[model samples]
Target: MKTITFNQKETSPIALEFDELIPDEIFTWEKSDFDSYMVPIGNSKFPLSNYFDVEVEGTAESPAEVVMIINGDLGRVKYIGAKMSNGQIVANSSVDLHCGAEMSGGSLLVNGDAESYAGREMTGGELTIKGNVKEFCGASYIGDWRGMTGGIITIEGNAGKQLGECLTGGEIRVKGNCDILAGIHMTKGLIQIDGDVTRWPGGQMQNGDIVINGKLSRSLEGFDYQEVITDPTISGKSFSGKYIKYLGDIARNGKGNLWLNAEKNRYLL
Candidate 1:
């Protein structure tokens, strides 16, 4: 893949917005083009070169043939790959909010933690985070009824609240622990939590599947207990442990499925 690299030289006190610097828009750009480009900061715009040194190598005819790498601290950069439809992005350090929101294709790999609204409203593609993510990861934008209509998000570390709130489609896998209200109000999709969950997952969910493989600290009263199954298959993925399944966020007349590791959540039995 052709590569475009950005090495940070300075950080602005005001966060920089990266919505205009995505691979989809810059695959054909030369170093000169980037040198002349401006990035939005708060209500003003400044030349992007003020913060990073740009390097471009090789050539590409399409966004899919390119790779963008951001090296150094990007903790003040937002919308790292928002609305991108193709290509790949690798952020080597912690990133600010909306890192991969509204993406429709390609892949995003974050070597460090991401702030809230990561992957919000994404319709396609894959987002992988190596560290913890804050609230609203893979969730709908506020005031929007639909969230994450398609794609896959894999978080190697813990996730904050509302991991997939109001989701309509796609898959989210949290390899580590997650906070409360994951998959809440979801209508379709799959959420797998490999580590412990705090409380109240799948609350008010109308339809969808949530598999919690670790200890559940508490269970909500909205779900009705269902029979336990050995090595249950959820969303085409087979899990080896005995699982306790429940249905409903009955308070909302929902029919979502919540599966918990039977051994870890025996208190709910």
Candidate 2:
């Protein structure tokens, strides 16, 4: 396997764009190639060597054989692994916006917090975030109708608003709290949240499933209450406790399913 390591040496006020540095594009690049490469920052370009000490090791015939590790403060680095088709990327610190936006394949593991658009419009692969994520963690771009169409996003920490906005496919599992409108406008997909939700999940969803294992602050009137189920299975995953099912977003004539833990949401019963 080929390994590439980037250790941050300096911090930039303007975010350094890294959409061109994925394993698919740099699997065969030598250290010298990285030294001469210019990185985009704001409206200008600068030597990547000025901000990071790069090390390339081993050989690879394909992008799937590559592994990239980035260490140190990368809070100003944008697009850490955007549009990658294969390979693995590990970031050891908090990342800026668009961390894994538009990725078609491969795996990205962020050891710390991630900014907005963590897995926007992803079609395949896995994205794991160890800490909290801001707004639009797995949603569509501004003015775009398509969101994450495939893959899996696992968030160990809290998620902000519009967690899976406009989702057409894929799955999102949140181990911590979630904010409002988790599956708003979704057409197809599954979202599992293990923590409390602020309000209004599946607001305008047309077709999809949202399973919330925690308490919900409020539910939208657009969803009509359905019968309660016992130890229901959702999207092939089984739950031990009873869940209350609801269907609607009839405001848009949606047929999405919303399941909430019966024990946690007694008021809804």
Candidate 3:
């Protein structure tokens, strides 16, 4: 695999956008070409040579053959690898917003936290975040009906509000807690939360699956209480506990499934 490394020389005084430097566009560029490049910071473009040292090694016939490594504090850098079709990207630090928006293929791994709109409108591939993420993780843009169409996002830590909103396809597995309205308006897909939920999950979902294994602070009145079942199979995975099934977002005539843990949330029984 071809590798491109970015080592920070100085942290950006203004936030930089690294969306344009993905494997799809820079696969053919050499180290010298990278040295002369300028990355967009806020509203202006600054010479990338001023912030990080660049090194591009090996050769690739396609973006899928390339591997991009960003090794520095990227908490102020937004859009690290947005809309990439094929490649392997690894960010060793926290990243700003839109980390993997509208992506079609390949894989992206953020070793730290990510801001809002991570994995928005993604059609295929994988995005893994090792730390907590802010709002709108795997959500669609405002007024849009479809969010991620394909792909898988696994957040190893807590996630903010509106996770996987308006989702069409794909899967999101959050190992930690999540804020409100998770999987809202989802048309298709699967969301698994291993931790507690704040409130109103699957608020208006038309069709999809949301499995909450932990406590739920509140549930929407739009859902009708279905019978509790044991060893429920959600999205092809058998969970070894009793679950309360709910149907409707009756407000939208939605038939999506919201499975809440009966053991953890016994008050609702």
Tens digit of per-residue lDDT, candidate 1, span 33-118: 99999899999999999999999999999999999999989899999999999999999999999999999999999999999999
For candidate 1, what is the lDDT?
A: 0.94
Q: Candidate 1: misplaced stretches above 4 Å?
A: none
Q: When superposed on Cα atoms, how far off is each prediction in RMSD?
A: 0.8, 0.7, 1.2
TM-score (C-alpha) between model 3 and the true structure? 0.96
Query: What TM-score fits each model?
Result: 0.98, 0.99, 0.96
How many clashes in each structure?
0, 0, 0
lDDT of 2: 0.95
Error of 1 at 199 (Å): 0.6
Q: State model 3's lDDT.
A: 0.91
- State in Å the error of residue 165, model 1: 0.6
Instruction: Give me the displacement of residue 124 in model 2, in angstroms.
Output: 0.5
Top-down TM-score ranking: 2, 1, 3
> What TM-score does candidate 2 get on C-alpha atoms?
0.99
Give one digit per residue, the lDDT tens place, for model 2 in 150-245.
999999999999999999999999999999999999999999999999999999999899999999999999998898999888877888889999
The TM-score of predicted model 1 comes to 0.98
> Of the pair 2 and 3, which is ahead by lDDT?
2
Model 1: worst 10 consecutive residues (lDDT sum): 232-241
